[model samples]
Each structure stands twice: as structure tokens, then as C-alpha cells.
Target chain A: MSQLKLNTEGMKPIYVQIAEWLETEILSASIKSDEKIYSQYQLAEMFNINPATAAKGLNILADEKILYKKRGLGMFVSPKAKESIQEKRKNQILKNLVLELVTEAGRLGVDENELISMIKTSNKFVGGRDHERN
Target chain B: MNVIESRGLTKTYGNLKAVNNLSFDIEENKVTGLIGRNGAGKTTLLKLIAGFLHKTSGEIEVFSDNPFNSIKVSSNMIFIDDKMSFPASLHLVDILEAAGNFYDNWDAGLANGLIDYFNLNPRQPHSSLSKGMKSAFNMIIGLSARCPLTIYDEPTTGMDVAVRKDFYRALLKDYLQNPRTIIISSHLLNEVEHVLEDILLLREGQKCMHMPVEELKELAICLKGKAGIIQELATGKEIYHKENIGKDSAYVVVKNDFTEDRLQNVKLSGVEITPVATDELCVFLTSRNKGGIDDVFDRN
Candidate 1:
């Protein structure tokens, strides 16, 4: 759980980074659906950030319906939290990275066919590696 | 609700105005960083709020009463600085006991725990401690006081890196338990930015920008690309800092008001955009000129 070392130098704000990190934890199944999540105070202490900032991060997830509050108990991950997070990341994170890859390829005089082949090779290599580990 | 409010607060030191017509409100239960360069009237403004100095003109209110020499304000507020000194005759532990009697919300247990944690020798007098130890002691008091309005002006002056880190964590943890209006004045925003909810930036005794810390991170963005493209794109936009990267490339910081599509287009045009860090953005905003120190070097 100590993997929350934030990139203070990155272009993304800390709260957004926190929200993304929690989504990542959920996606990785470290936190399961209907399970209690870290409170704002806990996040603040863990990250050495302002409680308000941590609260803001939690509120973002809550607003997205990935988390729901249970009165005084605290926030719990939604049952569909993983699916929603996956959908959001597909539309946002994966798309942005792909866009960057394509743009860089275009700048380097990489044709669409060559770019597609490179992506296919990379995907196969990564998939085979993961399968081997499994 | 606003825990502190100043209307055109002005404090003049004979021919010089240390605080000039500053008007801002600090909401309760929020940590605000009073950030500025040296001689930027940060201390003067904090003093005015702490009721140690009187303003030449204008008005400042703490808890709806004038803060100047007000008994009500003094009891409810704690101001910690490097210059804070306890009675010469009192031992460190004795001073803690006295403080316990003074503030209604004093947490003796927390104070003792922090004392043991820092390994502070309570038997020694305040003056006998090292600079770093003295600062740690002052911070201990500042935190244990649990005042409604806590003002810390560079409370980490002599602290080492580890001590500073622990101090910030302790401050944040305590604040979570007992929310209050805390103003931490520091020139180094990078160190304190994450700990702050809001930032009240000052420049030359005037308010520069006051906003949430998150919004300030997105206030401007740095763009690096071909000189022609960057210059053309920056036209009619508010440029905070600009410089020639090499011969054909230029780097410019401009207001981040671009739509997603425009930003995408800028990327397509080969312009790299990076978010301006809080400290760097403050430097750009408070810089006297767009050229900065390079202006002095580039007299061609």
C-alpha cells in the first residue's frame, strides 16, 4: 500500500493523481467491491498531503459513482467500480497514450502500416511474457 | 465562514509601505500558505493578523473583532516564528506546563509524546537548545496549543530535512483531528504547497493571487517548440515567462485556457506542453520583468 509516492513534478495535479491511484488499486483488485476504502484522514497521513486534497480525491471517485458513502462508516467501493474504472481508463488514459504513440510515430516518419506492425509485435511480446509468467 | 478578513489593509513604515491595501479573507478550517519573497510584507501581514502591530490605515478583523491588541484574538490565536522566546528563567518543561495553563485546548499528552519523539531535553532552558531544536520546540508549542487561528512564519527555519518532513506530517495529522484556520508563511512553495488547501500569494506588499492550491497548479503551462510556432500561438494570450531555448526553439509560459482540441492541435504542431509547478508559477507571476535575470546578462 506504500506505492502512493506521488510525482509532484508531473503535469497532473496531486488530487487527480490520488484519484487515479485509487482507481488503479481497485483495478488491480487490491481493494474489492463493497469493501471499505481508506478514509480521507488515512490518505492524508499516508501521502503526507493536505486532508482537504485527499478529501477532494475521494469526492471525485464518489461523484463518478465508483465509490459510495455509508453514513459515518466511510466510503466503500461500488460494485461496478472496476468496470467503470476500466471504461474510464480506456477512454482517457489508454487513448491519450495511444495518441502520443501515434503522434510520435508520425513525427518519426513511421507509416501507418509500420506503426501497426510495431504495435502488433509489442502486444504479442507483452502478451507472451505475461502468459509465461502466469 | 471567514475566520479572518482584511479590507484594504495597509501598514506603512514611515516612507515605505510594508503591506499595501491588501484585502483577503481566510475561511475557517483551511490551511492557507502566505507565500512571498523576502521583504514582501508577509511578516507584516501576519503580524497584523496576530495583533502584534497596528495597521496605518484600513481594517482587519479576526473573529469579527479588531485584532490589534485584542485580548479575545490573542487568546484564540498562536503565532510561531524563529524569534519566539520563552522566559529566560523557565526550563523547557516548565514553559510547557505554563502553556498548558494558558491555552484552553492545550494537549499535554501530545506535547509530551512529541517531546519524547524529538528527544528534546525538557530540563534544559530554551536558549541552551540548538537552532533546529529551538524551532522544533516552538513547533511543538504551536501544534499543542490547538488555537483556533495558528500562524507559522517560516517555522522550519533551522530544521533538517527529516525534521521538516515529520513536522509537516504532524501538523497535517493534528489539523485533521482539530480543524482550524492555519496560515503558514513560506517563500518555498514547493515544500509547503501539498500541505496547503489555499494559497495567498503576495508580491511587493500587494496581493498577487489567492486561490486553491489545485487551481494554482493549472494556472499556466509551459510550452516549448519552434520559435515561430510558439510566438504565433502565444499571441493575444497572457504570457508570463518567455525565453529562447536555443537558436530555433523557444520556451514560453502562458495562461492555460486552451480547449482540449486546441491543446491537441498544439501537440500535433509539435509544441510540448508541461504544467507549471506551483513554485515556478509563483516565480513567474512575481517576477519584475518577463526577461528575469537573463535580461541583465543579455544586453545585446
Candidate 2:
């Protein structure tokens, strides 16, 4: 958490970044299901941000069911949290990046076939063959 | 509960109105940033709230009582600035001890810990420390006092970069542990914006804008592209700033009220959109001219 450096210049707000970072942490299995997450105060202290902003981020996850709140206790990761986060990132984040990629490819006069082949070749180069088979 | 409230609050010095017809309510347990340019009446307004200065007209309240020399307001509020001073004969440690006597919430342990952490010589007089060290020492007292209504008017005046960062973090941590209504007036909003829940922006002794920090961040957006297309899209919108990039290109900052579809179409049309930073937005909002300093140098 101490190594988390948010990009203050980007279009995304700090709370959104914090939410995404927490999702990534869960997806990476660093925080297991039903594990307690950092409180707003803890996140605020770690990020040097307003506690309200940090709480907003925690609320975002709570709303999405990626995290749940226990009475008198802090937020904890929900069961299947990683799977839900992956599903969300796939639909929102990955889709947006692919949209931008396709738009730029079109502007560069790269046809659909060429773009598809380029993606496959790049994937292979990055050792994605095992995932590809899966 | 409102810790401070003002109604048409005005203060005058000779013919100049330092704070003019300002009305606002500062809620309890929130960190609000009071931002403005130099001589923007930040200090004057803060002094009025701290009971150090009287209002010439209208009304100002601290804890529902008139703040002008009121004992209740004076006892509950602590105002820290770069010019904070102590008696010439009092040593650094004695000054801290004296400050503890004034505020009921003072944490002597925290004060002593901070004094030792900053490596200040307890035996030395307050005036003998370097400029940066003096500011650090003053900040220690301000934080340890833990007054309900704490006002810091450019409290980081002489501190170096590292000390400034440490002070901001410490302030935030303390505020979280003990909720209080805190107002910090500063010129360095970029560094302190993250710690603030609300911002009260002043321009020429008047309230330019006061809103939550999140809303202020989204108040404006910048567009850069062909000047003709930019002008076409910017029509009927409030454009706060404009600058020509090249002969054919232009950059304009306008209100961020456009709908998602409109922004997508504008991007599809090749106009690049960018978020305006809080500090930049403040500058643009308070700027006298749309062209800024470039207008002064432009002979055309």
C-alpha cells in the first residue's frame, strides 16, 4: 500500500483510482476472500488523502459487492471478489482500451485482419500461448 | 453544526474593502482550504474569524457568537501563521508549555514528541531558530493545541519541501484521530488539495467559488485543436481562458458542463479534451483577463 502512487494528473479521480487499486490487489490474491480491508482512516493516512475521499473509494467497492461491511467491523472482501472484479475490468476497462486501439488502428489504415494478426503475434511474443490454449 | 458563519461579512481598512459582502458557513469536523492570491484578504478574513480583528460592517460568528474579541471564540480557536511569535525572553520549551496552558485540548506529550522529532533545541529562545525551524516549531504548537476551530494561514511559509509534506501528513492524521473544524489558507493548493474536503476560493476580497474539493476539480475542462472547430464548439459556453497554440491551433478552457455524448462527438471530431487541474482552475477563475499574462506582453 505504501508503494501505491496515484497519478494525480490523469482524468480519473483519486477515489476511482483507489477503488481500482483495491480491485487489483484482490485480483492478485494479495487479500483473500472475507479478509478485512484497510479502513478509511488507514487508507487516508497511507495515501495522504482526505478521509472522505478514501471512504468514497471503499463505498464504491461496497456498492459493487466486491467488498461487504460487517457491523462494528470494517469492510471485507466478498466471496468471489476476484472473479467479479475481473468481469468488471473486462467489460469496462479492457473494452475501452480495445476501442481506443481499434480507433487508432483505423486512423493508421490498418485493416481488421491485420489488426487481429498483430494482436495474436504480440500475445505470442509476450508468452500468452498457454493462456491462448486455455 | 456550523463552527463559523458569516452574513454579508465586510471588513474595511481606509477605502479598501479587505473582505466584501462574504456569506458562508463552515461546517464542523471538516478540513477547508482558504485559497487566494496574495492580498486577497485571506489573512484579514481569517483574523476576523479568530477574533483578532473586528468587522467593519455586517456580521461574523464563531460558534454562534460574535467573534470580535469574544472570549469563547478566542479560547476555542487557534490561528497559526508564519509570523507567529512568542515573548522575546521565553525559550522554545517554555513557549510550548505556555501554549498548553491556553488550550484545554493541548497534548503535551505530542508537543514534546514533535519538538524532539524536529530536533529543536529546547533551551534556545523562539527567535533564535532558523526561519524554517521556527515555522516547524510553530506548527508543533498549532497541532498539539488541538483547538476545535484551528486556522492556519500559510503555516508552511519557510519550511522546506520535506518538512512541508511531513506537516501536511501529520495534520491529516491528527484531524482524523480528533475531528475538528480546520481552515488552512495557502497558495500551494496543488500540494494540499488532497487533504482538503472543501475549498473557499477568494478573488479580490470576494468569494469567487466555494464548493467541495471533488466538485471544484471537475468545474472546468480544456480543449485543444483547430481554432475554428474549438470556437464552434465553445459557442454559448463560458470560456475562462484561451491561448493560441499555433496559427491554426488554439487551447481553450471552458465549463465542464458538456454531456457525455457531446464530449465523445467532440473527440471524434478531433478536438482533444483534458481535465483542468484544481490549481489551474483556480488561476483561470480568478484571472482578470482570459489571455492572462500573455495579454500584457501582446502588442497586437
Candidate 3:
């Protein structure tokens, strides 16, 4: 029941929150590829949101081919769901975070060279396990 | 079919038009929130649907037929108001038995389960229970009735915050198990907003806004920055509220979302953009000092 957490005060809409949560689940392999993910009803129960909102969230994944629906059954993860989700997140979410970091750094008078070295130093800490897992 | 439909619905009491020329169709199998300030006609509209009050002029259709005193509509709907009265002589058990006979879709098992969950003693009379207890009992009946078009007007009137959360959890659980058209009119927007599929906002007897809750959030945004900078940014934008937070910084809600290009100014101007909750939007939309609709039409 407590597998996924939500912030009611978060700025993102509920549907977007649901979608991102599903992505995290997929990436973490908690929901294996081609396995049955939550039905709208199950999601509605879990999040205490409208089933339609939950459906909208599922639809986002379906639209992106990360999830596929079966007739008379629930949605299933696409075989390449994790890769696709990671690719999309890296392109969009991670990019946004980096942009904000760079912008904040500039505001604080930190130069590009300093920021790059900081990123490099941070990257080395996760060196072997991250690449091996990927 | 639309679960409930109102076309040019007008209900007036003497000089006051409680509901003015309102037209909206509530779709089946969706939870819609009917919200307004006190005396803004939420109860009047629900009462009209529940067959307790007839509209002064115009139409209200429930399940494709006129609802005023119609047995058909009454059979399919249960209107739960917090202070709903039961015969004082009849005990809670008797009322529960009577409720089972009234609604066709009633689930006795769910009724029993909810009774236990809320820790109610069925032997106690309705009049003897405290306000919070009364509300909890009302909720048990409403949830167990399983009516197709169920309406709850301020169902959490006297319940504490913990009990309110439990009620919402039970509501979502039941709703997931059995889909129905549910309408709740409550002042606790922050607690209830997540459960709502759409919001039908009323102000001074007129339908001010009707849209999905997500869209409502997108339609307005809160901006914070230097007083002069915010003032400049607010020009040509629909400003909901503006106030100086300190000597230099100010908080402003404008009718727009800030973009990178939009907030790019915030960076140079030392301004910050932040989240605005729906409750704030609702307050600004309904406040008297805001001049609401009057301001829109007052060109001078």
C-alpha cells in the first residue's frame, strides 16, 4: 500500500505524479517488463484520486509505447519500458534539473569551469556500480 | 446519459436569486465537486436535484427526468447532509434497516463494515449522538447506499482531521469497487480536491468556473519578486491578488503560468515563482473584496 509515495502539496498535477511514479517503478524493476501494472481502479484506490485521472496517467505511458493495453485486461509494461522511460527522463527531467543547477550557479557567480569540475567530482563517486548496473 | 443536467436553472427566494441561470451537465461515473461560499446556492442546487426544492424557473433533470418530488429520481439518489434528521424515537439500527429498504443498490455488508470501522453503536438513537458521530453515521449510510447519483453536502461538518482522512479513504475504496456519479459540496477544498474529477465553482448564485482541477491550476499562477518587478510583470495580466510581503518583495497571483522566458525576468529582477494551491485560487475567485464578476464588466 505504501509502495509509492505522493506529495499532495507538490506543484505537479496528480496525473503527472502518477505517470512519473509508474516510470520509477518500471525503472526500478519492481514492475517487470510485459507484466500487469496497476489498473485504473487499483491506482485510484492507492492514490485516492479519480479513476479518470489515474487513467490519464496510464494513458501517458500507453501513448509513449512504454505501456500497452490488452483487450478485456489491464495495461502491461512494454518490453523496453525502462529504457524508454530513462531515455525520456534523461532528455526532459534530468535536462531541466541541470538547467536549473547551471542557472543557480550562474546566479551565485560560479563559472562553467567550476560547475564542470563539480559535476566530474560528483560523477566519480558513483563510478563502478552505476555503469555496471546500467 | 448525463447523470444530472441543469438548463438555465434559476432558483430565487424573494429578492435573492440563489441559483441564477445555471446550465451544466454532470457526466456519469465521475466525482464532481460543487463548491461555493455560504449562501451561494450549493444546498439549493442539491436540494433541487434531491426533489426537496423545485426551481423557481428553468429545468433540472436527474436520470433524464424531472427530479422534484419524482419517486424514480428519489429511488436512485441519496442526498446526505451532515445534520440529516432521522426520527428521534428510532434507534440507529432501525434507521439502518429503513435505509436498506429505501435504496435499491444498498449493501448491508458494507453498511455493517462501515459501522464497525467508524465504531458506531447501532443501538444508540440519532438525536443522542454527538455532531461528529452523527456525521460519521450519515457517511456510513451514504457509502453503503451505493446510489447511482449520490450527493453529499458538507459530509465532514464536525469530523476531526483524522476522521476526515478515514472518510475520504473509505470513499475512494468504495468508489473504486463500484463506479457511480458522486457529487460532494464541501469547504475543505484542499482535502477533497484530489478526489474530484471536475470542479463546478459557484459565486454569488452564478456558475463562475467549471473545469478539471488540473486545468484550474494551470489557468492561474503565483509570482513573487521585487515589488516593482512584480507590478511590471502583472501589467496586461489578469491579477487575482497582489500584496507586498516585505518592504521590497511582493507576492502576486496572475492568470498565467510562468515560463522560462517569463521567469527569465525573475532571475534578473531577483523574483521567484512558486506554487499556488487551489484553495487560494478558490478564495480569490469568491472573495467579496475581489469584486469578482463586477470587476470584469466595470470598464471605467
Candidate 4:
């Protein structure tokens, strides 16, 4: 997948948006492991961002072992990049949802029991008939 | 080992000291932004480095050799000025051919691709193109030439917003592909601020400030609060600039060592702080009337 379109008007830096896009593509299997990624120049051209900004995003992926470079060749997705990204995404979502639920509960002056019940009800709706089997 | 280095570099044209005692080192493989007001000697500095003009005093070195009429050193550097001239009778194809022979690392494919992308007709005479189109053609050469030390002095003069944006994008893209020392001098301050890694600000033909963008941002703050409280807080400190609207006042300055508790006790209704931008910083620095290097340094 190409780099996600960035909202220049947004307060967040464009590089952060680029990193998020790459992570999403990796988790969704749109960019498979061992697939060749666009060079920094191509990415900069496509996004209209400074190469330094593009390089910073790619460096983040490299740090996560999502992408690796071959000397004189080009950058490619790591062999286990998909699995790694998936695991990371799962953890991130869980952490974010928990934080959101706690914050919402506190704001509404609801206790832990009330929050757990709300979660159970939502899970039932989401799981559908599978809730009965569980 | 300096790609470009100058010591007490001064250039004077009759009564006007176009460049004054400026000294800086431009390291290899890094992009530096040359910025200043219209008569701030940015063009003069570029010309000196490109060896198009002789300096009045001091020294300049490019790749450990003087660039004045030295073909070996000059070939490695390309200066694309706003008033860049070519033979009016020559065709665009001939210009490209000449540039290809001039630079050792010229990429014909990139030049051809850019020519097509910009919709430039190679068969057209050099003088026949519109001013904006001519600027675009110059940009094509700057990008595709692949010079190690490329300097652009207001290379986007007559281009519209869209075309200018395209040029910036192409510049960034090409720089990433081939990392080198590039200096861009332009008056469109805000547009180029994001792409610039470092800024060399000049005023009245003098180097006022040189710092990395992030570092410079950290040093400046825009503070708004009660006029009385702001005066008290700003007392015995350097106030670069200030604005007042009745009871409300705002002060811009380099970040100082002031405690929040002290400011809180001032009983101001509110205090809003934000980072000062490069352009704002330049205006503040150059707005002073003193005509000396010390005055410039003091303001900065």
C-alpha cells in the first residue's frame, strides 16, 4: 500500500502520520513481509514531504524490525514483519480501549462493576450468537 | 575537509557593504538554508562561493580549494540564480546537452523525466518560455544535475503557488535520492521553513544568526498576559519585540530562565506561550536600526 494521505492541516507531524500508515498496512497484510517498499525518494515524491521526514518514518519501521535494508539494493519488509505488527497493534488497541473505558467511567462517576457490565453487554452485541456458545 | 568555508568573508560594492565579515562552515551531505532580507547579501555570498564574483576581503574555500575560476572546484558546484542567463538563441535541448557535459554526475533519465513531468518543450528557444516556465526549466537542471554543492538563489521567482509547491516536492525527493550539500535562498520564508534543517540568517550584509531550526524554535517564546505583569516579567530581560492591546500585551524573546511560580503570582488573567517561527525571528532581529555586527548579534 502507498503511504496514507496526510492531513497537513492537522496538528500532528506528517512523519507520525506516515508511520501510522505503514503500521496499518503491515497489520492488514496489504504490505506483505519481504515485499519491496518504495525508496525514500519515491515516498517523499508521493507525500510531498522532506526526505528527512520520510527517512525518520522509515527509521521507526526499521527500529521495529518491520523493514530492513539491503546494501545497494533497497528497503524490504522484514520476514516476520506482519506477525510483529499484528501483535503490537493488538497490545496497543487493548491498552487504548482500557484507558478510554476507565476515563469514561470516571467522568460519569461509574464504578468498576458498572464499567464491566457495560463491556459485557457490548461484547454480547459484537459476538452475536457466539456469545451463547461461550 | 569543509565543502564550503569562509573566514571574515566580506564583500563590498562601492558604498554598500554587500557582505560583512561573515564566517561559517557548510559541512558535506547536509542541506543548509541561506535566508535574509532582499539586500541581506545572500546572493553575494552564493556568488562568492560559486566564484562568479570576487570577495572584497577575507577568504572562501570550496572542497579545500579556492573556487574563483578554478574549473575543477567550480564543476562540482552549481549556482542557480533567479537571473540565470542562457544564450537566447539556444534551444532547451541544447541547454540540457551543455549541462550534461558540464556535470560529471548528471542523470539524463531524471532530466528527461522532469522535462516530461513539467511539460517543457525541448525544441523551444530559450527566450520563448514564460518567466515561470523558465524558472521551472532551471529547477529541472538543478535537480537532475546532481551537483554535490547546489545553491539556489531565489530560483522560484515567478512561479505560482502550485508550481512552487511542485518544485519544493521535487527538490526534497531528489535530495533524498542523492544526499548532498544544498543551499536554498528564498524570500518565501514559511514555505521553505519545514524543509530546511538549519537556517543562516543575515541582515544588512551581516550574519546575524545561524542555528538548527529545532534549536532556534526552542530558544524563542511568544508570551501573552496582562500588560503590567508582562512588563514586570520582562523587566531586566531582553525583549525582542512587543505588542500591546489595552490591558493585554505579548512579548517575544529567546526563552529565559523564569520560574512559572513567579509568573503565577503576578495575578495575570492568563498566560499563553507559543514557539516563535523563523520568519518572525528574522523580522525581530533585523528590525533594529543599529548598523554594526554587535547590534545584530545583540538582537538575536
Best-to-worst lDDT order: 1, 2, 3, 4
Sorted on TM-score, highest at the top, how do the candidates line up? 1, 2, 3, 4
lDDT of 1 by residue, B1-300 (tens): 998999999999989999999999999999999999889999999999999999999989999999987999999999999999788888999999999999999999999999999999889899899999999999999999999999999999999999998898789889988999999999888888888999999999999999999999988999999999999989999989888977999999999999988998898888899988889889888886656777788798
Residue B81, model 4, lDDT: 71
Q: Is candidate 1 or candidate 3 better by TM-score?
A: 1
Best-fitting candidate, measured by TM-score?
Answer: 1
Pairwise TM-score winner, candidates 3 and 4: 3
Give chain B TM-scores in order: 0.98, 0.98, 0.93, 0.90
DockQ for each candidate?
Answer: 0.78, 0.72, 0.62, 0.21
Residue-by-residue lDDT tens digits, candidate 2, A15-114: 9989988998898889999999989998898888999899999999999999999999999999989989989989988987897788889889999999
Clashing residue pairs, backbone N/CA/C < 3 A, model 3 = none
Q: Is the docking of candidate 3 incorrect, acceptable, medium or high quality?
A: medium
Q: List model 3 lDDT by residue over B1-300, tens digit each.
A: 699899999999999999999999999988999888898889998999898997899888999989987889989999999768899999988999999988888899999888888888889888999999899999999999999989999999999898998898888888988989999998778889888889999998889899988788677878887888788889988888877776988888898756756665575556776768898788888887855565688778
Query: By summed lDDT, which 10 consecutive residues of candidate 3 chain B come out lowest?
Result: B260-269
- Over the stretch A40-122, how does candidate 1's per-residue lDDT look in tens digits? 88899889899888999999999999999999899999999999999998998899899999989988999999999998999
True contacts kept of 2: 0.64
Q: Write the per-residue lDDT of candidate 2 for residues B88-150, one digit (tens) a residue.
A: 899998898888889999999999888988899999999889999989998998999999999
* Candidate with best lDDT: 1
Candidate 4, residues B266-292, lDDT tens digits: the string is: 323356555576677677777646243
Please give, as one word, the docking class of candidate 2. medium
